[model samples]
Target chain A: MACGRPKLRVGPSQREGGFTDSVPATVSRMENQSMRITALIVCLPLCAFGAATAQGLLLQRAGSQAENRPVIPKASKGDQCVADTEIMRKDHMSLLNHQRDETVIEGIRSEPYSLVSCVNCHAQTDTSGQAIRIDAEGQFCESCHSYAAVKIDCFTCHAAKPAAMEVIGNAEPHLMRDNPHTLVSYLLNKEANE
Target chain B: MSRVPVADNEKSLQARRRFLQGLGLAGMASMSYSLLEVKAKTPASSDKRWGLLIETEKCSSGCDACVRGCNEEHGIDDAGDDLTRAQWIRKIDLKDELTGNETSLPVMCQHCESAPCVDVCPTGASFKRADGVVLVNKHTCIGCRYCMMACPYKARSFIHETLTEQKPSAPRGKGTVESCTLCVHRIDEEQDRQPACAVKCTEEAHSAITFGDLNDPDSSISQKLNTLGGSQIRADLQLNTGVRYQGL
Candidate 1:
């Protein structure tokens, strides 16, 4: 009757009800109404799941390559403050250039676009028009990064300081690092000694 | 961890080639058909949609063709560089503290099936291309670098300042988080151009960069990964990245 005994909306008790003497009747009424509400909610999820499953199929077909892609969440605007670039030493560049033929891409956009992105925004122009890697502290990186919040250790291994105006030629040969060649090698070498 | 199996087809591929001395482009096309037919005849794995064959054993801590390949094929030309305006697919270098050894592992935007970057991009600039390469749309990018902070692989770039020569957003700009594109643009447009790193890499050294649709069982990336062992990086993140690391 009247659609499941009226809605049991929460509110301050009826000020005019003189209910000081009728508490038992009020409690019973509320319990009966609450049961109906409970029954209604239990079915919501089941219905939703059915609808979602059908929708998921269409979305999957529309976005065919959706399944195997990675799932990185969007960062809040606070991340806008994160530093956009990291400074690195010329030595690091030379060391990594095992192929030896240097200057393949001219700038960071060529081979290693990610690493080059550091240069793209961080490289500053002098009055003479020669673009130079800016001081990391005063860079656009430190700007919003200081504002957004969080710090990354990319600056530690990578040079946060300004690099030399000129790239020093590969004057010295590099020695090979002793890092693990594979995941197994890494695990075994790390656990073996311990 | 089991080792990922290798993609070995050189002998068969060579065997399928025919010597048509006077063949024209049409003949070459017919020959190519035979080459493809031979591969099609092979009993490929049935579970096609999500298999990758990464030979982690062969992955040289030294070579980074995968990282380099995506950059070149995408034509991301940000030459005058600044660290803050950085971008590219990164190759991870892990070091052994006691042994003083280092392992160079190529890594990039893993293109998670449920990507946080897409969820986090306030402007909806970060989106995946139809063919599987995940990318950030430069036009919609507001120069806000939130996507960079959200990316686990640190795969995004930003254009920082106003330059006399404002390069397009192919490589991302001065203030965006730039990572590997998986050469979606190249893969979509060019009928035959493969990813840059895979083509440039020397097979003998370490053929690390493997590109193909992992979901397509017959694809090179899928078949190799299926036969080999591959594990996603940072599995704890719950992001099913398109790219997988083998051997680990």
Candidate 2:
């Protein structure tokens, strides 16, 4: 779109080394053509990027004035004050996924519900306002076993699966980071004793 | 764009070829090796049909040794933001009927015979071995990510960035497509070296995610997958992915 000049009808002269006997007759016929098509393919995206950067500069200009103030600059995605919706969507998805991975990084809860030593899975409820049992229901451990009228064999070897550990819900002790195992030496001693 | 005469085009092509030759570049067996005229990297054929069968049940997810060890031996980056260093051996979780629980094991590129990634790639960067395995070249890849969409298992990732350090074993670059090579660099180069992932697994926990000839019944990988009733992921695609799953 940058091209406004009219096309030239004449090809380069014979003296021009870049062209010679190898030059096609069609090339002379199309001498007026600009490299618009080829350049446009690569340049359109770059122009959009430039437009975005310009918008960012404008927003930063107005926002710089306010001090200890919450600055809410009014601008659209196209105006470049913010990331385009598509980029924001991907970033948001990645962050949510990271949180999910982090919450489960400790793997599984090791202790029984009665022991507050393990905090990864089991937690306390707030209504009781004390360290209490959490109602974590996993479909794998609960649904089918109950349907078959079979008492779950899970407790024999393993405890119930953690339920929604990543979701920040209304449970109070679940929100707290208090720990039963205090010192590394104490943990080592406890492990050695067990 | 200026139109060139047929004769001129032919001259241009000849000049291009001569320029390439002068630059000390060699092309492949095919004519359109035109594109890779200077870098004839991929091997054409091996006169042998090689294949691998994976035993999923024998795999243990917590043991990252196979993943870590493979990365070390193959010179592959164990982890990275870009495809070049992304040699991820993922551990997938699934539910079970018998125990009604969470089961996990390592997963990787299936190296399908009728690979969809190869089919979809606009550029011929992703290719298959004369033997059954599939692979990709980092240099030629434009990072279009079409291969990612074509892969049924979602095994591929378009690495958008680079990492600080490079692995000496599996050399990698930035902004490309990469996946499990089944330790192809070792298989093709070294004199019969086992894949790093398989070698790293401790026998006591769950023997190495065994790989061997799929055709031979006596082969350990074959024996395990067949007898244990291991299954493949998204078999509906009928790519016949060489990799199989056990828990789910």
Candidate 3:
């Protein structure tokens, strides 16, 4: 844990405005006495109640914090995450946003930070053995996001689950340059015919 | 021509040397061709302009294979009535008034070189990829539907209802305008697959659709265009659509 330097508290004597020193000492002393008495009378019950409530909430939170921690689902494929847990927790959104632009506009799809990769590794399976969406309730992305109270708009426009295996693995025959009717073949055929 | 008379031994040696040189040249040429073929399989780049050639004359009326394939690939089911349903590709029948000649063709996003949808989008959501595939970035889409109004081909569709079970490759949602992506996901993938519509059409033996890189002069689609010629749907608009139609 990193420790922060303590901030200096500048009192009225140290302030650039020395107007407080111009007041009569007797008048200032009487005013300070009356203000202190009024504060004690007004804040006694409020501070006591506030402190009791805060203590109770803090105790409750401390006891349940471990139980309330997000239940991260086990990854389906990789033994380790693409990034450190701390780095990903803080910077995954920016990484995904940057990658999305690179892909959508520039047509550079080979980047490592793709949202599809996240879904592929994190999506969980239900009791029926069907793959559940990563953003579904109690799932990988949702469990943490709901605990943090941060609503994500990603799953709204993006898929929450990985694509079916066949969809990714099915390799159909390409019919472009390989076709016999291509320009080179067409020219060659024409020349042969001639 | 008179052959130069050299020693028999020297003549055989020269012949062997020539044979070795020819073999080396052949090997180099084959290696270069293989290298070029391997390079072509990489993801889309600015150097390539992917497009489709639709032979309308071969497209049979009432054939909805392309439409069905597109819907299935994108997981777009019947979320609403016909008027409200999102259609990425649709079959349209055309008839000439004077000659009474009938034609049928599949109409989708033209993927214009200077797309009006890209121009009209307020949020810069409707954008054309460097490889010429136009797509809607649903994350930034404000659902204004200005792209729908600006499109001359009426290709764009507005998603009105919240959607679920969208294909992982093709993510879509409510309150956004979308259109045909030309199977950009498939194009980006390292696998050897064409667009679903073109694949289905070829499987059905119609062979009416041809997807290829327009920038590659050696491509079959470019060769066909150079020889037979194709027409844009609205040529007067000067949009320079990537999708072309033959025998229109």
Top-DockQ structure, candidate number: 3
Which lDDT tens digits does candidate 1 get at residues A69-168? 3332232112221122231222233223411111111111122213333433345555796643333444544444444444643332233322232221
Residue B108 CA error for candidate 3 (Å)?
0.8
Model 2 lDDT on a 0 to 1 scale: 0.50
Interface RMSD of each: 17.5, 23.6, 11.6
lDDT minimum window of 10 residues, candidate 1 chain A: A99-108
What would the per-residue lDDT of candidate 3 be over residues A1-194, giving only the tens digit for each residue? 75899778988765966677677766766789999999999999999999999999999999899889998888866555666777679978966876576566555555456787788778888888788988889898999999999997888777787666455434333422232312333345456767
- In candidate 1 the C-alpha lDDT for residue B19 amounts to 22
Residues A1-23 of candidate 2: C-alpha lDDT, one tens digit per residue: 76788886665664466456676
Query: RMSD of each candidate?
Result: 25.8, 25.6, 17.5
Off by over 4 Å in 2: A1-194, B1-52, B74-87, B97-99, B163-165, B202-205, B216-218, B225-229
Off by over 4 Å in 1: A1-194, B1-54, B64-82, B97-102, B163-177, B202-205
TM-score, every prediction: 0.41, 0.43, 0.72
Best by lDDT: 3
Candidate models: Cα lDDT each: 0.47, 0.50, 0.77
lDDT of 3 at A54: 100
**Under CAPRI classification, how is model 3 graded?**
incorrect
